[model samples]
Target: MVRKIAAAAIAALFVPVVQAAGWEKLWTFEHGAGTSVAGQTSEILAFDSLNNELWVAGLKGVDILNAATGSFVQHIDTTAFGELNSVAIRNGVAAFAIAAPIKTDAGSVLTYDTTSRSFQQSYLVGALPDMVTFTADGRIMTANEGEPLARPGFATIEARGSISIIDTTKDSVTTLGFSGYDGTTGLGRIVSPGAKPSIDWEPEYIALSKDGQFAMVTLQEANAVAKIDLMSQQIVSVTSLGLKDHSLPGNELDTTDRDLPGNVSVAGNYRNAPVFGMYMPDTIASYASGGKTYYITANEGDSRNLEDFVNGEFNEEVRVGSSSYVLDPTAFPDAAALKATSNLGRLTVTTSGGDLDGDGDYDQIHVFGGRSFSILDENGNQVFDSGNQLEALLFADPALRALIDDGRSDNKGVEPEGVTVLELGDRTLAFIGFERTRQSVIAIYDVTNPTAATFVDFIVDADSLSPEGLSAYEFGGKYFLAVANEVSGTTSLFSITPVPEPETYAMLLAGLGLIGLAARRRRG
Candidate 1:
C-alpha cells in the first residue's frame, strides 16, 4: 500500500523554527523497520535527481519517498543481499553496499534502476562494504570497514580495510588497500596493541573533493585520514589527526557528571584536565574554499566493543579511577586527588593509548572523540575546533538541557556524529547532528571563513531522536535539509531559507512586489 502524508499535514507545512534559525519542518516519515544495530531503521539517505525522490537506506532494504512531501512511495526489499549499510544515487541509478552473510567475508554493491525500481547489476567488493557513493564522472567509491571480530574462546578474525573503485566504462574495479602502511608510524596514526595498521584501521566514511580529483577517507579507529588520488587510483597520503588538548582553557570538558557537588546528572562540571581527546570522526564532508579543499568532521567517539566488558575480553575503555588504573606519580603530582570522582577518576579513557613511556603506568590520559565538530585542511591539519561549544550550549538552554540523557554524561556529550556542507545562497554552512541527544539537535555554523568559523544557530526538533544522517538539497526553488533520525525511525524534511541582509531583503521585496510586510508561516 502507498503511504502518503495526509492532506492536513501537507497543508500545515513550512512551520518556522521558534528558538533558532528560521527553518520550518515540512513533514516526518516514519520507516517502520528494525535492524540488529540498536533497532535503527535509517542510517543513510540518497537523492534521486531523475525521479526527484529520496531513497532512505536501512538494514532491511531501501525506502523510496517523495522528497518534497515526505510521503512514502515504495520500498525495494534486498534482504538476500544481507544487511544494507549505505546507498548512493546519481544519474538515475541507486547503488547499495551490502555485507555478506558472514560479515567477515567479501561484500557486494548492487545497482538498481530508480525509475523502474528493479535490480540492474551487482559487483563484488571487499569485506563489510559499509559506505558507497558515486563520483561525478560515473564511478562508484566504497569504504569497506572490515571490522575486527573475536570468535569463541578469543579467536580473533580480522578483515583488512580497503577502498574499492568501480569504473563502469572499463568494467573493472581497482582496490586501494593499506598493506603498504601496515607498519607505518608517526603522524598521530595509532596501531592498536597486537594489531597491524592494515588490520587495525577501519575506514568509516568517505568524502570527495569539489573537482573530483581526490577522495578523503576517515579511519575512525586509527584517528587519521587517508587521501586517495582518484585520477591515479592510489593511496597518496595518510595524515594523523592530532589530539585535542583538554588542558587548554577553551577545551574544558565535564568528565564525571554524577560526582561533583550540586551536580545533577544533566549538569556539567566544566573544567580543564590533564587529558587529550582523539578526533575520531564518523561522517565527513568536503567543500572548496580559497581554491583549496577542507573537510568537516563530526567527532563522535567509539571504543573497541563495549560488550567486551561483559564478554570477559580485553575492553579498550577503562575508568580513570578504576582499581586497575595506574597513573604515573611524577607525571601527575596529585595522583590520589586526580582519581577522585569529582576529578578525572570517574571519566573513561582508552586503555590502548597514553602510555608515553615503556613503564606500566600511564604518563598521559587519552579519551575517545573530541565531543565536537572540527574543520581540517586538505593535508589533514586542524584549522578550527568547536572547543567546549556544544557542552556550553546545551547547559545554557533550560529547554534543551531538560532533554539530556544523564547516562551519557560520563562519556561523550552531545556526540556530533553526522555532518554535511551546503551552499545556501551566499553562505556555506555546516549542519552537524548530535547522535547522543534525545532530541535531534543539528547545530549550524557559518564555515564560509574556514579559519575562523562561527556558530549561527541550532535546528532542534523534539519529535526526532539520534539523527545519524544529514543531507541538504534544493528543490522547486526552495532549499531543504533532510535528517534521518535513527532512534525515532523517522526521516524529517525542513525548509531552510538563509536570513537576508538589509539590502538583500529590500531587493527581494522589490522583486516580489510586496506592498505590505508578509509574516512567515508558523505551524508544526
Candidate 2:
C-alpha cells in the first residue's frame, strides 16, 4: 500500500522520503528451490563483484548465478564432500566450510575455481572454518567456529570458535587462537578454565571493510565482535558485551533472574544469562561513506529484565531493544575501553548537521523494531521517534490515521536485514532488504528524510527468494543488488537503474563541465 506524504511537508520538515515511480519484478531462477547438499540446500551465500557472479553454498552443492541472465551457470555438487555452511569469493576464488552430520566436528575449509567452476582440494588441517574471508595480501582466512561439540546440558555447542589463517599461495594454515578460551580439542563436553585457548564465542559471520585491511566477525556466544588485522595475521581487538551491563543496583543473580526456570548457573555450558537471553549478534555489515567506516550489527532481541538488574540486586541489567554502536575500530587499545560505552542516548557527533558536540564523529542512525523505527543524532540524542510522532499525529485526520495504522500493520512491516544506498534522481535512496520472508523486497526511503519512506514490491516469487546475504556493487555503469538465499540455496540478482528526466541530466552535465573547467584552470 502506497501512502503519500505531501511534498511540501517533506521539503519543510527536511524529511528523507522521496517518491519513486514504482518497483517492478525483474527475474527469478527456479533451479535453487529445494537444492540440497548433504540434505540441505545451498542457502544464499554471497555476491562476487570481482567475478560478476552469485555464489550459493549449501549442504548439497554450490551454484554460481549468472548476473546478466539470472540463471545458474554452474553447480559444485558437494554430496561427496559434506554439508556446507558459509562461502566467500575473493580474487575470483570462492572458499567455504563443509559442516558434517554432527554439529561440533563438521567443518572443513574448501575452495572453488571461479574461472573453471570446479571444486579445489579441501584445506583440512587448519580449516577451522565457520566464516571465510581473504586477507589484503590475498590469503584465505577462516574464523573457525571452533570444534563443534555438544555443550554440557544443551546438546549442540560444537564451535569451540577460533580463527585460522590459510596462505592460499603456499597452501599452509596457521591457527590464531582467541583469548580467554579453553575447552576440549574435539567433540567432547569440557571446559578447562584459563585454557587461554583463545576465541570461545561462536563466531557466526565475518565482514570485511572495503579496503579489505580490516575484518570483523560476530561472536554470538561470547557476546562480542572481534576485529582482525589481516595483513599482520593478528587480532587487533575484541568488543565484548553481556547481560551484566543490564543489571540494576539491588537485583540478585540467582535462577530467578533468568528466563529459563531452575538453576541457570548449572546450564553453565551456554552461559545463558537471565536478562540478556542469548546476547549473540546474528548479523554484521560495513559501509565506507563520506571518509569514515561504519560497522552495523543486528541483535535479534534481548530477553533479560533490566528492571530487576538495575535494582542492583541482580548481577547484570539486560538492555533490550535494538542498539547502534559506531566507532573507528582502527583506534584500538586507546579506544578499546570505549567499546563498553554505547552512545546509549546521544553520544555521537555529526559534522554535516548541526549535531557537532565535539565528541566522536557520530552520524545519526535509524533503528526499527516490530512496530516502529527511530533516528538518533550523534549527541546520543534522538531526533525523531515513530512512537512519539504517531501519538502526536494521531489527531491529524481519519485518513492519515488509517494510513499510519496500515503502514504499522504487522504482516506488512519489514524486518530489515541489509541496507544499501542508491542514487535515485537528485537524492540517494536507501534500499533495505527484509528477512522473515523469502521474497526479495526493497524498502526505499530518502536517507535525507526519516519520516517519509516508500516500500517497493518484492523482486522474485515469494516462494523463490529466501535471501540471506546482500552485497551491492556497480559494474559497467549498471547497479546490481546480489542476494544470497539461505533457505532456497541460491543467490538472486537485481539491477538498479537510476531513471533521470532529461532536464535532470542537463543540470548534472552543466555542473560537471564547470568543475572540470575549474580543475583545468587550477592546473594551468
Candidate with top TM-score is 1
lDDT of 1 by residue, 1-524 (tens): 11111011011111111111347788888887432223338778988878889899886688888986787888777788788999998888999999988887888999999999999889988889989998878999999999766676666677888899999787798877888987667643554577777777888899998888999999987888899999999999999888899988667787887664665453655677899998899999998888898999999987787246236555788899897879998998898998987777778888788888868888989888998888989877889888776656555454466656656767887789999988867667789999987788887777876886655556778888999889988777778888888888888888877666511111112332211211222235
Poorest 10 consecutive residues of model 1 by lDDT?
A: 2-11
Instruction: Encode model 2's per-residue lDDT on 255-356: one tens digit a residue.
Output: 211222341212101111112112234455554444434444433221112234234221122112114333333422233333222212211211221112
State each model's C-alpha RMSD to the native. Answer: 8.6, 15.0
Q: How well does candidate 1 match the true structure in TM-score terms?
A: 0.89
What lDDT score is found at residue 278 in candidate 2? 24
